[model samples]
Target: TVESRAIGPNMTACHHSYGRPDLLVYCCPPGFEKSVPFVDFELPEPPSPVKVRRPAHLLDESFIVKYNKALSIMKSLPYDDPRSFARQAELHCQFCTGAYEQLNYSDTPVNIHRTWLFFPWHRMMIYFHERILGSLIGDDSFALPFWAWDIPESMPMPDYYVDENSAFFHTERDFSHFPPRVADLDYTTDQNHPHRSNDEQIDVNLKFMYTQMVSGARKTELFMGCTYRANDGYCDTTGTVEHAPHNTLHTWLGSSLNPGREDMGKFYSAAKDPIFYAHHSNIDRLWEAWRKINNRRLDITDPDWLDSFFFFYDENLKLVKIKVRDVLDITKLGYSFEEVDHPWLNHRP
Candidate 1:
């Protein structure tokens, strides 16, 4: 219902000091300094409702194989193709690294993170990403599998993404955190923390989720994040869930050998990794779950927040525009998270 203004101007490209040095090679596009009209148009409604997107850890072998095959087809596409895997990944780098400008806002930079748009924007992102993969495999019902890392048993990287021969595999992830190794939910760059037993770690993980999901994020602003209006420029705050396990996992999975933790560790390169989509799918599910907590939590209602918009190339590689409103009802998009045990909902400590 709401249309987005032009994306803001390209901001100065910078790098996080903690990231690998080699990643500096990526720069804003040559003519990206000038504003370009982001094509805006409505897409025809889907012929049917979206499919049920399931957790990566819970996927059957058939689903896993189909998922991998879709990715393989996407990866095999020519890089110059808008729907190609390389172009798909580059969309992350460009938007995140300050390549576009907000429309009608004097070219102020428009970064998706650290603001309310983070959730809806990313939802649209993976939505199109899933569509692209599905179209490539000629399976309109295909959906992306989420990484349900909150579950203790599902903490390790899903085997579907780790096989070396799989197009989903990326060598940059932390080898020490591989399967048979549970994730440290509160992990930081700090490497000196004393190791705890698997039982102890799982206990710690559950407690962290309890605190983050219930205690820490009890309201809209606290849960979804601060608002960003036109001319607000890049956001200064990040939402609660986006801050915790979301970021911690990114840093933990980053490759030690690659500069700036190619693919997973940094925003500019994260989408390059196939696991990035899975990780985000889980994050998206958390948003749905967050709303059902006590039936008190709800999405923010600010018009500016609701009006925010973003663009993505659909499965057909045709440029299409989307608004934050389009994603509020995932069912309309024809997708829903697979039902999983919500042990964290009952956790109190």
Candidate 2:
């Protein structure tokens, strides 16, 4: 079993309802000062003609090539460099593995997954990551791709990630899930559902999407999750969708062969894989689609939800603190998900 280090003065103890042991996380670690020495409070100006990220399956050869090049460069940088692949992956570890404390509530750890911080915190993480990747390749308008795994036609891992030579390729993934093989979104490590035919699988997938994305998320709290306040103990309530498809996909992608399932199955190592970003892009896209369902089904407008904040290092290596309010608009952030068909809207199981 994986165990976190002892809880320190700067850590927060987490409580869960899943019968798991309490977890202690580092919300902010010591010595890793939160800012770029030269930069002030605000982040540097974003590049003009902001990129419109599209589905990984739909990307052309040139974009794929450039994308790999950018990743390769990122991976080759020094481990100490904040923008390096190792350092970038550590950011995920820092937040998820208990490396930092909640700013004012240092004794209370920061757990972004089960609380309202999941979506916006990750959106900012990926935003800065995308920017850093683009800056490495001198492409101001470059964008990351979303894995359109919800669609039957795009369910398998994108071919770009399977190529052995591609920077996106990670040998740690479950090869049994390689393309032309569809992912089981509702997959569980301990349970097995009898195999279904392709048509049957698509039907199941669509119905599951509808159930998780719509029916299961009818209320604001049910959708965005419970709030985390300063000095609060570990957040135990996870939103419906975040608990379902979002968590399901993570376990589904982790290679069973690797102990602790580094890079995908576990939170601390998930970001180590390039495909993790695309996987999350899809999750982020679902958040966008959910809000557009109707006037009644919108994001939580709670003041506590909007005012919550998280910190991250920007492309320029500047540590910036952003609020949930700042990212409610993706357009203002200068990026958007490529439009795609929502086949699950009417697939009411």
The top-ranked prediction according to TM-score is 1
Summed over model 2, clashes come to 9
Worst 10 residues of 1 by lDDT: 10-19
lDDT of 2 by residue, 153-197 (tens): 898889999899889889777887788878787877775666766
Flag regions of model 1 displaced more than 4 Å.
1-49, 294-297
* lDDT of predicted model 1: 0.75
* Candidate 2 Cα lDDT to native: 0.75
Model 1 CA lDDT for position 344: 75
**For candidate 1, lDDT tens digit of each residue in 1-349?**
7654433333333222212334444534334344445556453378865678887777898888898888888888886677888878877776665555556553465777777777887888898898889888888889898899898878888987778988888887878778877877888766797587777888888888988888988778777877777775565687788888888888778886765555688887788889999989999999888888847447676667766776677876665767776678777778888789877767779
